[model samples]
Target chain A: MRQNRFVEKSIEKLLFVAAAIATISVALITIFVFRSGLPAMSGYGFANFLFGADWSPGNGEYGILALTAGTLAVTFLALLIGIPTGVCCAVFLAEILPKRAAAVFKFAIELLAGIPSVVYGFFGLIVIVPIISEHVLPLWQRVNPDAQTTGLSILAGGFILAVMILPTIVSISENAISSVPQDYREASLAVGANKRETIVRVLIPAAKSGILASIILGMGRAIGETMAVMVLTGNVAMLPKGILDPVATLTGTIAMEMSYAGPTHQEALFGVGIVLFVIILILNLAAQAIARKMGAVGRE
Target chain B: MNRKLGDISFYGIVLILSLATLAILIVIIAYVMRQGLPHISWEFLSQSPEHMGREGGILPIIVGTVFVTLLALAIATPIGVGAAVFFAEYSKEGRVVQVIRTFTEVLAGIPSIIFGLFGFAFFVVFMQMGWSILSGGLSLSLMILPTIIRSTEESLKTVPLSYREGSLSLGATKWETTVKVVLPCCRKGILTGLILGIGRAVGETAVLYLTIGGSIRIPTSLFDPARTMSMHMYMMTAEGISREKSFATAALLIVIILIVNSIANFISNRMKGAQ
Candidate 1:
């Protein structure tokens, strides 16, 4: 009995050690990135580094203002396109569709999530870029004959990201929608409300926290995404005058230059990473808090 | 009559939008298959490239992908399962659990590129592992750690408390019951979690590309530089070389992802039914 007790205690301790690995890693990543990047940000002047327009490493200019604008623009545009479509799909799956059809749709969403981002980037490169170049660019040119774009622009990046984040939003929102108590729906019907009315009035409002959580998570994804936007946006460091104009993102800038960056340049890239990290961390905490609230309400 | 018409049209619009969502995936697959199918000869799969992927096959790249992915799972499985076990069994509602769970969520929210930066700065530069299969696999292990833990914790949650009670009443200790009784019951769920983690690690391009040294050779050891299939595809497109091979790689990647997703779904379904 004593030996068994010893064994049990040791095993628990071992598991504790194992569990600490993730905590340690999170600490290490935060420390190393900040340690490496903070100096460059300070030396470069926080204002200059954050709000400068030019980003030429060769010239020692490390302004990320344009990248910040470009990232926000792309993320905002993606949320605009993704949220409505994804909610519609979720509502269809949760409230409207039959079980078997919903199963098929869920499979597709899983498949969508499973496909690599690089492949999505590839699809963007070959498929979306050409369509924009040929079809959309011509429309711009018709308005202003001097207008030119290779079709790799902020819009293309946003479109690809919207498609990429669809699975995240739809799956989560569908779960939130379906998990609303059946009594809510039945009560609406008892009060002479139609199926549509129940879903629109009660189901959506009750599930808003969850749906909002999904959107925040999706927003984090859109902001952090690197390869797809890197391949889609023309990687121009200039602030885009319009969606059709090319621009660089924070992740894109780091990715494009990290392979061969000098010391200062490397530091600046890490600085870019710090910016990206803080934004995502905020979004993650927000999503988690909202999710926790939703869970608490569900239990009550 | 107008209310009925409104309901009909609302349902119609939702169905159309849902179908449109499905059509997007179909079109992408069709387009890729159309471009990539002709390039999938046996020789293309078996041979090594001659001129930086402009001339030959992707055998080495495939081998690198398998080796790196398996290595990552090897490292991630133990730690993730252990953490999940701890969370399910030993841990209580307190500050430590809160901290750990928060950090894991933070870790998950982290971008792969940031992971790339961390891997580059720490493993490659600080640890002096240098760009190799070891560094790449180690870095990827952290990236997939959250997925494995969440899924395993989920399955662990499904294990009935009565099983442990029975084991303890019969003189088995907590560790023994957890090992012999509790774990075996949820092996399928654990397997599903590992497969899901594998799915996350396999097609990863951004993380591996930063740490793996981007070589197109079969790595003979953990210290050797190598490139995975995803990296190969990304390079082909990024460098503007070999469109046919790029699509072929993308097609194979999609095929692998589909298989992994289906397997995970199948196992989870069976696990639920058995429970």
Candidate 2:
């Protein structure tokens, strides 16, 4: 019996070691990125490297303003395009759709989410980019033909990102909407509200906190999406002058240059990564706070 | 009347958008099939690209992706399972376990590109490994570690404490009991976690793009640079002329993912049946 206790304690010890390893590994990664990025910090100095716009590797000037601008622009555009659609889809699945149909739709959304990011980039490059070139670009040209490059533009990247994050938003929002107890809907309906009125006025308000959390999470996904934007967004390291112009996001810059970049350039990329990390961390914390508050509200 | 019209528009909007999500999938699949179906051939699957401009086969990528993923899983599985065991079984619900739990959650939430950046900076830069399969695999192992830990921990929690107590009463050592009774019972759930981890590793592009240079040639060694299937697809599509080749690659990847996913679903269903 004593031997068995010893054996169990040892197994437990091993588990602790494993968990510690996982935490240490993540910390090591973040540390290494910053450590490698030190040269760029020394060379360009912190303020100039971040605030400068040009990212010409040949000239040894590594400003990330352009990439930062690109990442924010594309991510914001994706949110603008995706949020309304995602919320509506959530509402339709949670409220409007028949139960059987909602399940199928939910499964479909999960499948979409499961599709690799590379595949999304591949399809976007082949199908979406060309469409933008032939139709969307021409329409844009009619409005502003004097606009810069055509094929690979911010609009192109943003549209693809919106598609990429749609599943994430819809699935999370669906979870939030469904978690609203049925009694809430019934109570609203009993108060002389119709189905549409009950959902719009009562269910959504009740689920608002959770739904907001999902949207914030979706925004994090949009900002962090690397492969899709890397391929579709013309690798131009310039601040986007117009939605139709080429631009590079923070993620795109890191992925595109990390392979061939010199030590300083690589560090510069890591510096951008650090910034992206902090933003994502902030976003996640905000989401968690909102989710907790929503949980409290749900209980009440 | 005004309120009714507003509600009608809202419902109409919801219907249109919900259906639009479904429409997006159909459009994408249709487009892929239209462009890729003609190009997929058995020969293409078995062969390699002839030159820079010619239509290429994904044999190297298929081999490379599998090799790296399996290698990374070999490294990740034991450690991930150990961590899960510790979190679920060994550690009391205390500050350290909570911190570890939060850490894993943070890791899971991290963007894959950052993992790539770290791999490039650390393995390629500091370790002086150059761009190789080993670095890519290591990075991938890190990326999938949380998935394994989370899933395994959940499985461990599902394991009844009575089983452990029963084994203890029988004079079995805790280690022996855990290995004999607890692990075997949760094997199906642990296996499910592993399957999902493989899926994440296989589908990854950003991390591999940094750690493994997109070399389309067959890799002769783990230390050598090799391209993955997704990377090949990205390169082809980027070049813009190799649409057919790229489409075929996407189709092939989709097929592989579907097989993995279906197997995962099957195992999960079997687990449910057994329970």
Candidate 3:
């Protein structure tokens, strides 16, 4: 009996160590990234690193304004393409589809999410990049004859990112829409509003916070996506003047050049990583706050 | 009449948007299949690269991917399951548990590239693992930990409290009850989570890119550097070398992911049916 108690106690302790690993890993990552990344920023001067436009690492210039702008441009473009379509699809699954059909659609969306990011990058590289450079660029080039163009452009990255984030948005928004209470729907209908009106007004308004949470989560995904953007974004370290121009993202720069980079350049890549980490951390905290608010509302 | 028209148009727009999303999925699959299906052959699956991954097969890359993935899962499963067990059975809704939960959430949301950076700095460079399978596997294990814990906790929650009470009344300790009564019931859920973790680990590219060393040879030891299929595909596409081989590799990756996903779905569906 004493042996059994000892075994049980040891097992409990073992499990506690295992559980604590998550917290330890996060702390290590935070410490390591900042420790490696901060010195380079301080050496380069914080304002120069953050606001300088040039990224010529060979000459020791490490301005990341263009990269930050590129990340914002592509992510914003992705949101422009993803949010409305994702919300509508979520509503269709939650309210419009029959129960059996909704389940099937939900499963398909999960499958969509399951497709690897590299495969999306491959598809974008072969299919979307060609279409943009060959067909779309010709039209735009007629207006600005000297515009540099490539198959790999911001548009391709944005489109692939939009698809990549669709599942995140759709799944979360569907849950949000479905959790808006059946009484809210019936109440809206009881007041002589049609199905569309109820959805547009009462159900959507009630679920707005949750849907907003999903959008924020999707933004996190879009901003941090690496392989797809690395493949399709052409890795140009310039400020993009239009969607058709190729631009380097912070994530893309890290993945593209980290392998062959010099010591200073490598640290700069980590510096890019620091910027990315802070952005994603802020976005995640906002999403969590919104999700907690939604949970409280649900409990009430 | 105007109100009815508005309703009709709104419905049409939503329906079109939904169909468009589905259409994108279908088109991507179809396009990849069209480009890649003819290139997949027995030879392509069996041979090693001849001209920098352009002229030969992907056997070495395949072997490397499997080695790293299996090693990652081996490292992740026990720790992840243990963590889940702790969260489900031992921990209360206290400050410690709350902090752990927040940490896991943040871990899940951290970009794979950031993970790559951390892996490079801490494991490969600092620890002198030097871009080996061990470094990649350890990094991937960290990345997939949250997925495993979340899914396992979810499954563990489905186990009835009555079973624990019954076990305890029969002179079993809390740990014994968890191991014998509760865990047995949620084994399927645990399995489902494992499958999902495998799927993500197998498909991961960015974190592996820095830590895995991007070598196209089979890793004979844990410390040997290796390149995964996703990394191979990324390199091929990015460097504009061997588009045909790249397509073939992408096809294989998609097929692998689809199989893993289907199995995961099947397990969860079976669990639901059992309930």
lDDT of 2 by residue, A1-300 (tens): 666667667767767888888779778977886676766766787888889988898798888899889998899899998999999988888877898788678767766776789888888877788888888877777888686565788888998888788877787777788889989988898989998888788888888888888888888888888989998889899878888888989898888777677766666788888888878878766776787677631110
lDDT by residue (tens digit), candidate 1, B9-100: 87777777788878988988788888987898898899998788987899999999999999999999999999999999889979998888
Superposed Cα deviation of residue B103, candidate 1 (Å): 1.0
* Candidate closest to the true structure, highest lDDT: 3
The positional error of residue A114 in candidate 2, measured at the CA in angstroms, is 2.1
Ranking by lDDT: 3, 1, 2
**Compared with the real two-chain complex, what DockQ does model 1 have?**
0.81
True-vs-predicted CA distance for residue A147, candidate 1, Å = 3.2
Q: Which segments of model 3 are wrong by more than 4 Å?
A: A1-7, A141-148, A296-300
The candidates' DockQ values read 0.81, 0.63, 0.81
- Summed over model 3, clashes come to 0
Evaluate residue B197 in candidate 2 and report its C-alpha lDDT on the 0 to 100 scale.
Answer: 86
Q: Model 1 scores what on Cα lDDT?
A: 0.89
Query: Would you list the clashing residue pairs of candidate 1?
Result: none
Fraction of the true interface contacts (Cα pairs closer than 8 Å across chains) found in each model: 0.80, 0.73, 0.80
lDDT of 3 by residue, A1-300 (tens): 899989988998999899999889999999999999998999999999999999999899999999999999899999999999999999999999999899788878887888889999989988899999889888888998877677788899999999999999998888899999888988889999999999998888998988988999899999999999888888899999888989999999998889889988888889999999999999987888888889831110
How would you order the candidates by TM-score, starting with the best? 1, 3, 2
